[model samples]
Target: MINSITQNALRALLYEVTTEPKPGLVDPGSPGPHSDMNIYTFIDSSLSLTQYFNDAVKIGQTFTGSDLTQMFFALRRKGLAAEKAMLAATHGVNTHKGAIFALGVFTCAESYCHTRHTELFTTIQAMCHGLVEHDLGHICSPQTAGEKEYAEYGYGGARAEAEQGYPIIEEIALPFLKDSTGTIQARLLDTLMKIATRAVDSNLIKRAGNIQVIDWLHEEAAAYLALGGYATDAGKQKLKQLNQECLEHNYSLGGCADLLIVTIFVGLERGYL
Candidate 1:
């Protein structure tokens, strides 16, 4: 029997790689802000994490008692293994660090939902209670780019998003994705652009060292959306311009890029998109 959690986790990761014209993100059509990482790199990263996803599903499937802490620790073990696999696949490049965290949560949360026969969204949210303050909010030396950004800007990044079960995915990207009209690719492209205009991406801060950059990026995207945003001739030209600007600035809306996958995963699980 196929496990929905594992299937959906892989599907979400694949969706992240396959979606095209994702401005400031890696895609088969374009390499955004990265010379080494491409669609193939992401594919390799996904392949490396396959066993971790399966293990996550198994964690929830095999849980018996009421202690979610055990599941969290078990997930940590799998998460560490998955990180090692991702590093090996990318030759130490961080291709899907954000994807690993986001997808791992969904993978485990879906398994919990399936095993409990409960609704998924709430289950995922419940699984992530007190996530940030416990996991990433504690005092520690800033060792990573994201950690430095978090310490300075207080954006909360992926940890904050996970703490709330990713409200950005639940509220913004998913709605835009579900309600978008046209082909699936077109809809997702629109969703990606729409999402960029709404929130402060931690990756943007990590790259640009300011929260204002995210807002500026949002304004640019909002302007493009007003011009019909990848749905019309003018919008396509504008998108190209935006793509160049992202490359020139050496910044990627990678945080939004990561959440887009989670949004797609949620959409599939909820059966709307």
Candidate 2:
């Protein structure tokens, strides 16, 4: 039973990483998707972190309950092992670094919720409460995209998002997942664009060297969504066009990609998607 949650978590990870036509993300069938990494890198990263996900599940299942602080710490230690395995697998490429963080929390949260048979969002909130304040608030110098975005723009990036129990995922992705009627791939594709249109997406901003890039992404994604998203025939063409647009400019919606994974993980845990 404990390992089953880990396996489900792996499915969420695999589903996120392998889905194609995802604008600017590494996916199967995209021969030369992004310059820095490829589909193989993402597959390697996901496969390498299996044990870490399982370990977090075991730790969460064994936890004594109401100890979110300690659960988070244990997950972090487990996260480090995942990161090491990722680096080894990808040969130093940061394929799923954001995923490692988000999925680590999700795994721990899932473990706790499973052990207690609690609601997914409630347990996730408890697991990640004070994340930004306790972990990222004291950074003297912001270096990474998340930290720099927090320091400069006051956008907490993933930490702030998690601390708030992922408002964006709840408000945007989950609703889309529940209401949208289509195959899982079609629905997830639409939801991914929906998130792309709204998320702060620090990864896109950092890589493009400015915030305007994400703004453009928002506009482009909104326009594609306006055409009916990935559910319609025209929307499919629009999505492909958007993919070409991003690929031409070397754009990657990695931040939104992470949230997409979060959305999928939550949906899976809650049996919504």
Candidate 3:
């Protein structure tokens, strides 16, 4: 079985690769089509090694998110950061434009993966791995059969949905603990609280729209923490404390996705997920 640990590791990998656009997947039917072709070629033409991580941190800095939306928000931040980094790295070749594409694809991958759709995830991951070797001369492992199948179908589904003007969050996003009356996953939620608190404290979320979503998630997390008391008083207190602290700091959404990841893993560990 694909346990939560493996799922999380896969999520982390998926998150990293998707932050960059998939090479060779651009719609020929779309716009001016790679007009300049230098950095564009490096991104739209093929994946690059600039997306890889070292010691679990992207290049050097760590990504923060404790919920799925928070995760997307963080990727959004990463995309912006990538643009700046690439600008600095390539002596201002406008490499950051490519970084925006990467972030778009990352959001795309996350939307698909959460919906149990693996197609985009597979293709993106494969391209990213290829980039690792081609651009960086570092060979990573080949993608598995499951990933391949996801790639084959995920694209078509995504395209069709886009044509219909549907939000991917409703159709493909990850499930949250508060989305249902289902049991609470204490350990995971707890970790998520910590991550969320850190993000808010760090001033990661500045946009009003993003802040609204994070605020909602904060309420959801509070509810989850309260529910977790069914398992143990200690769990309840820990969660309560986390929630209180988050409230004190003005609840940032940047870390929500990571918190969600932790919650899911904890639930799975406790047999709640």
Candidate 4:
């Protein structure tokens, strides 16, 4: 079970980076807006986190404590180590930092649910309860990008998403991906845009240096989906244009990308991918 769960987590990371034409993201054909890293960097980073995924599952499978939050803290410590490994692999490039958190929580939650015969999302919610308050509620001086975003815009970023059990993945991306048709690339691209429509995307905001860009991002993604989303020529053109614009503005929808990774993990676990 641990091997399978870790494999799915690795697959999810690889799948998200390989999905093409993703606006402002690193892909095989192009590095998109990022000037620091490329597809190889992401691959190296993904490969480096295998042990972290294994540890997450082991923690979940063996946790017998009543306080699931403690389990979450244990996983977070491993996640910090995973982030260091990812940085080492990428030579200081911050590829997969967000993924290290979101995917770690889901991988841990999935294993816990499998062992206890409980629901996955609710287990995640229980594990992540009070995450936002504990991490963001007492912020006096902003340090990380997430803390800064919370300080300035009240956006909770990944921590808030986990606390809510990843509503975007549960209610949107997974459902959209399950029902999506066409090539795997097309399905994932469409699902990514759908996620972009709803995700706050702190990375995008940070790159644009304004929270208003999220509205523009949402509008563009919604318009792309309205054009039939990667299956139609018009939708493809729109995505290309969106990709160009993101490159021009140097905006990266990394938050949405992390959501897509977690969605893919769950989809794979549920046998939909």
Candidate 5:
């Protein structure tokens, strides 16, 4: 769970990303059929990733009013090196914290746009299917030790899903925020670690391949919120209640991994992801 401060700040940014429109990236009007509470960002990296990275550096520098931008750029060099070694995508990658921000953006997009647009929904499902194929490989394939861990760690893991694609997604997601360095940082990192473990899986094809991916993502978010710290009393209570309901239905904790996605999005929407 992200510390209250980082979580709040991240939530604020996500809200801005969804509710406000900036040039050369996502147009708030284009995604279509939006609501006051529901917001969206274009998911394709080509549209907003570079601008978002630049804007984040600018915002960070402005917030701290130091030489952090150049410092951030410098740190990015090493991150680039690390990414290259891993053969990963580096488009939106600048820091690990960016992954949280990106997830927030994804949640917003899903909540606002894709869920409503039949065309986009079909496209997204295809993208999801592609993501499953790209990240998961053949669902029916044999399991290795890594695969076994993937099957057990979160929603997809219990059904014997693989984990190769999850790390790759994480690698692509890095590089948006500064490293965790304070109490808030630790909390954010902890939250990030928890979500990172489950987010991709919640969105992937289930091991049994039976349910909507978002259903699991929502459950994961509720579980995380139920964990107490960093949440409002109401948020905590709501999540706790949801967790109980989920348990009553016999869903495993791992099955609710999408909670990370939901938590980030809902938190961002409510000004807390």
Candidate 6:
């Protein structure tokens, strides 16, 4: 089970990076807005986290405690090590930090769910209960980008998403991906844009230096979907235009990308992929 989950996790990581023409993200054809990392960097970073995923599954499998939050803490400790491994592999490029957090939580929750015969989302919510308050309730000084976003905008980012059991993935991305029709790349690209419509992408905000950019992003993504979303010529042109706009503004949909990764992991685990 651990090996299978780890393989899915790695596949999710690689799949997200390799999906073509993702606006403001690294792909095989372009690095989008990112000047530092590329597809090869993401591949190396993804490969380096194999052991971390293994440990996360093992933690979930062996945890016998009733308090699932305890299991979450154990996974977080492992996640720190995973982040270090990611940096070491990328030579300091932060390619998968958000993914490591979101996917680690899903990986751990999936393992626990399987062992206990519980539902996956419920297990994730139990593991991440009060996560935002616990992690960000007392903030005298902001360190990470998430902390800073919380202090400034009250946006909880990934923690809030997990604490709510990833409503975007549960309610939106998973269903859309399951019903989506296209080649694998087309399905993923459409799903990615669908996620972008709702995602309050902190990376986009950070790059644009304002939260207002989210509205524009939402509109652009919705318009792309309206034009048929990676299937129609108009939709493809919109994506190309969006990609160019993101590059020009140095924006990145990293939070949306992370959500896509988690969604893909869940989809694969549940046989929707």
Alpha-carbon RMSD, each predicted model: 1.9, 2.0, 19.6, 1.1, 17.4, 1.0
Q: State the lDDT of candidate 6 residue by residue for 1-273, as single tens digits.
A: 449999999999998999999999999999998889999999999999999999989988899999999999999999999999999999999999999999999999898888889999999999999999999999899998889999999999999999999999999999999999979899999999999999999999889998999999999999999999888999999999999999998999999999999988988987877
Tens-digit per-residue lDDT, 1-273, candidate 4: 349999999999999999998998999999998889999999999999999999999999999999999999999999999999999999999999899999999999999999999999999999999999999999899998889999999989889999998888889899999999999999999999999999999999999899999999999999999999999999999999999999888889888999999999999999888
Which runs of model 3 end up more than 4 angstroms from their true locations?
Answer: 1-182, 185-230, 258-273
* Model 1 worst lDDT run, 10 consecutive residues: 118-127
Q: How many angstroms is residue 228 displaced in model 4 relative to the true structure, after the best TM-score fit? A: 1.0
How many steric overlaps does candidate 4 have?
A: 0
Better structure of 1 and 6 per lDDT: 6
Evaluate model 6: give its lDDT.
0.94
My TM-score estimates for the predictions, one after another, are 0.92, 0.92, 0.25, 0.98, 0.26, 0.98
Which stretches of candidate 5 lie above 4 Å from their native place? 1-126, 138-262, 270-273
Model 4 poorest ten-residue lDDT run: 1-10
Better of 3 and 6 by TM-score: 6
lDDT value, candidate 3, whole model: 0.35
Error of 1 at 198 (Å): 2.2
Q: Which stretches of candidate 1 lie over 4 Å from their true place?
A: 67-69
- TM-score for candidate 1, please give it: 0.92
lDDT of 4: 0.93
Model 3 TM-score (2 dp): 0.25
Model 6, position 80: C-alpha lDDT score: 95
Candidate 6: where is the Cα deviation over 4 Å?
none
The lDDT ranking, best first, is: 6, 4, 2, 1, 3, 5
